[model samples]
Target: MGVMNELINRENVGMLAKILAEAAPGSHWPHVVAAASELDLLSLRARTDAVSRALLADLRLLPDPGYPTAARAFRSALTAAGFTGWILWPVSEAAVTLALEAGSGADPGKDFDDCLALLAELTPRLTGEFAVRRLLAADLERSLQAIQGWTVHPDEHVRRLASEGTRPYLPWAVRVPGIVLAPEATIPLLDALYRDPSDYVRRSAANHLNDVARHAPALVVATAQRWLSAPDSNTAPVVRHGLRTLIKNAHPGALALLGFVPASIAVNGPRLDRDSLALPGELAFDFEISNTGPADARLAVDYVVHYVKANGTRSAKVFKIGALTLAAGETRSVTKRHAFRQMTTRVHHAGVHALELQINGIRHGHTEFQVRV
Candidate 1:
């Protein structure tokens, strides 16, 4: 895949300028274009901020310039100019910057509320998730109160944003300290959305809860329990995804909630096909599990790879091997292959690595292997 920074490059930046020029006639499109032209070596976020600053300067020069004026221009761009996609990133950012600036005025509350609405509108074009962080940080209660109403919004995108935008650890988005301080703050939003009819919205709600689980596992388990109690057709998957982190850590509450309880069982070798492999190779293994108890046992089988880090320490990463049910005294065997390909997200070091099996939140069957660069 192409680097994410390339998404907001000079070409798309010029397109954004052209669209903004159409939306608001006589604006300095050239200035925005020039700003992007000079951005040769900026990261994705830095490029977005630089372009936003350039757009904000132009927005300020509009007739009777202010947040309202900028909002109107953006609306016109969406409706009249038909602008959309990655190009809208800087547009949304500029609008938010203007809105936050407007928050220092006579009615900061109204400005905050208005900005939230603008974000809802802009979300359908391009996510306002990153932009809304500033507003949430600026006024947590007010912004959340406004977002609470969005759970019932007719549009799925807006409903998704209601949960996605408020996530405590939303990737590629700024941190909202208030969210971390009050972990339970966004629970109400997730509660309203976890059973949403739209998979799109429910997915966001699931991810939001997962983010919460990062800091407060109990809170997530509790929330998930409540969701399971009054579940709809899609609630099970939502809860599973939401509790994924907790499940990986083998949290008892999370495992039990998904019916992956402790059971009398026996595990055999995660027997390796080979003990050593080179880069771009695969490690194949198999394991057998027998339900030793009289009762049937449901299992959530997963594997952990203890990778050799650059500093010679090992870091464990979990990978899932689908779930299954074992009848009374039943035994099942499974085989899996894991690739050791170099990825941008992970570096391969020449050292001893290990693999282990996890079943129903329990670890079993350890095996070590050597990797060569």
Candidate 2:
């Protein structure tokens, strides 16, 4: 089973139940386990969602387990279970689910504050991103106000969530169309977090900025340039990671901002061990790079494999091989093997395909191969 499938298995469920039972002995957890166990684990989403719902229902069984208070009770349970400094624990989904459940049933006038408090408590453990998105959907102005407050929170995790939760393209969560439409709104939060003392917070800020760059490339490039102008240790990496998508796409503005100028180099003797391979086989290829420039050349060596689709269209996937500063008159030889093993995401198709070597976003050489299934 994959990592997600294994995360909430029998053993994990028992641990979670024990933790809950210990934290709030009066709150029945045995029934929670029973309900959650019936969920189908055929896929990660189905299992997580089903269990999240089951957990929320089981919490409702408690005698007047109040909002925000119950969320705090769960947080206490996590800490008692020795999960105090951990982020994204196995039981995180349960906390997030409970937050969403409470928020969904909240009375806008009386329960709003309590719901936000619950989300604040849950954000550090698993994530409040999904739960916050629901609030944003209901009231963008109010939800954003709450998120803005978290930007300066004493807890780095809460500050990180301020940026991460509002991301337009947060992976594994539903996309937020509003953010894409107005990527500008998230800028202030990211700016507040760009120089966060915590690497964890900084990484989230970078990723959040990268999501904005997807919709507003020029804006993000400008933002990165400004951030890099006063480069600190934290901001430098944040800028690099934030501009990663733009760099990968070979956006000229991003390339110029990063100073990954085109270099003078020559690719020689592109050779494949075999021109064809069957399913479950691997393809090995070799190539040589010679620096022809008079000065040292900083190079980002990467390869792209153009895979044939079922309809005869081709999709290219880029993989980074190495990054180095090659001295003048230097030559380096590289060998790489690509596996055609079956995966849940990719299906092998028998056809001729193309491979290209790219140096600092410049294609250096091209070759072809065939795959037979």
Candidate 3:
């Protein structure tokens, strides 16, 4: 089986940027941008680095060739350039700062609306997050109103910003102090985009609400129930995704909702290695589940493989598997696939390893095993 190689060295990113730049100067930015995303997982921590920050600053100064599709390239470039502190620093703060400073307080009505309009136009291409931060830093009411106004815009992109801009722990974006301050106000914005026609916009709403749910479980649950109560085609999926974290790890209410029951799911069993069937090998596993429900569900499975490393350090790798659908009264059998496979660099040593089954992103059951090779 072919393994997906992890980005350890930045050979691809560095080389691709140069190649693209030489082949197509106008589109080189995107190449660099994609390279950055490709390398994001390899970084030791979840923040951008200093060199990446410098790149963003430079990219911001370069003039665009004025292409439309190339327009998104700007935001992607900004994201790529952050390199570090992308999520750590407040991005929206800087944008709103620029917006406010560019405005004249003397004319605050139509002029303010026009000013916001300009900001909205540039929003997809600019930064947002620290938007709440910037709002609090300057004029709170005005900033909130602007974001609220953005929620109703004809553009799906604007509506998306209304939610994404407010997400807590938004990656590479700064946290908004305002969200922590006037948390209730954030609800209206979430509500506006809750049933947005665009699935893209809806996902943003789900993520934002999920972030809020961490802090206000009751409020989030209430909002979720309000939507789930009716099972409106639109809101159901939104509610499910929004409540993912709560559902996962089996929060009491969520567990009850899912009708979870504890049973002796795990059974010690042995199997012959289809490959050799020569030496005595030990592997532990367990299971049984079928939706037999009304809807086609996307289930998430979680597992952590524990094995002794060649360096003698005990280690583990957690992974996801099998997002499939089973109709009502349907029988779907899921075959177990190893997340972390036999590696040339790592040897299997006798020790303990753990695995868990997650339904809809929630961990409903778990088991452990001893493997020796």
Please list the Cα RMSD from the true structure of every candidate, rounded to 1 decimal place: 1.7, 3.9, 10.2
Model 2, span 1-373: residue lDDT tens:
5666655555556566667778876676655587445645446666666556566667777777545556666667756544332222324455544444454443633355555656677666666666666556555666787788888899887898888789898877777677788888888888778988888899999998898887899889888888888778777778878988777677778876776778889898557789888999988888999899999887777788899899988898878786778899999999998888778789878899888887788875678888898
> Can you list the residue pairs that collide in candidate 2?
none
lDDT of 1 by residue, 1-373 (tens): 3477887888878877787778777776666888878767888788888888888777777777888888877887886444777767777878777777775667777766888998899888788888889989988998999999999999998999999999999998899999999999999999899988999999999999999998989999999999889988999999999998888889999999999999999999899999999999999999999999999999999999999999999999999998889999999999999999999899999999999999988889778999999
Residue 364 error, candidate 2, Å: 3.1
Expressed as tens digits, the lDDT of each residue in 208-254 for candidate 3 is 87888777777777777776666557887797678766665446554
Candidate 2 lDDT score at position 204? 91
Worst 10 residues of 1 by lDDT: 79-88
What is the lDDT for 73 in model 3? 37
Q: Count the backbone clashes (under 3 Å) in each candidate.
A: 0, 0, 13
Which wins on TM-score, candidate 1 or candidate 3?
1
Ranked candidates (TM-score, high to low): 1, 2, 3
lDDT of 2 at 71: 65
Segments in model 2 whose C-alpha atoms lie over 4 Å from true places: 9-33, 40-42, 55-110, 293-295, 327-330
What's model 3's overall lDDT?
A: 0.52
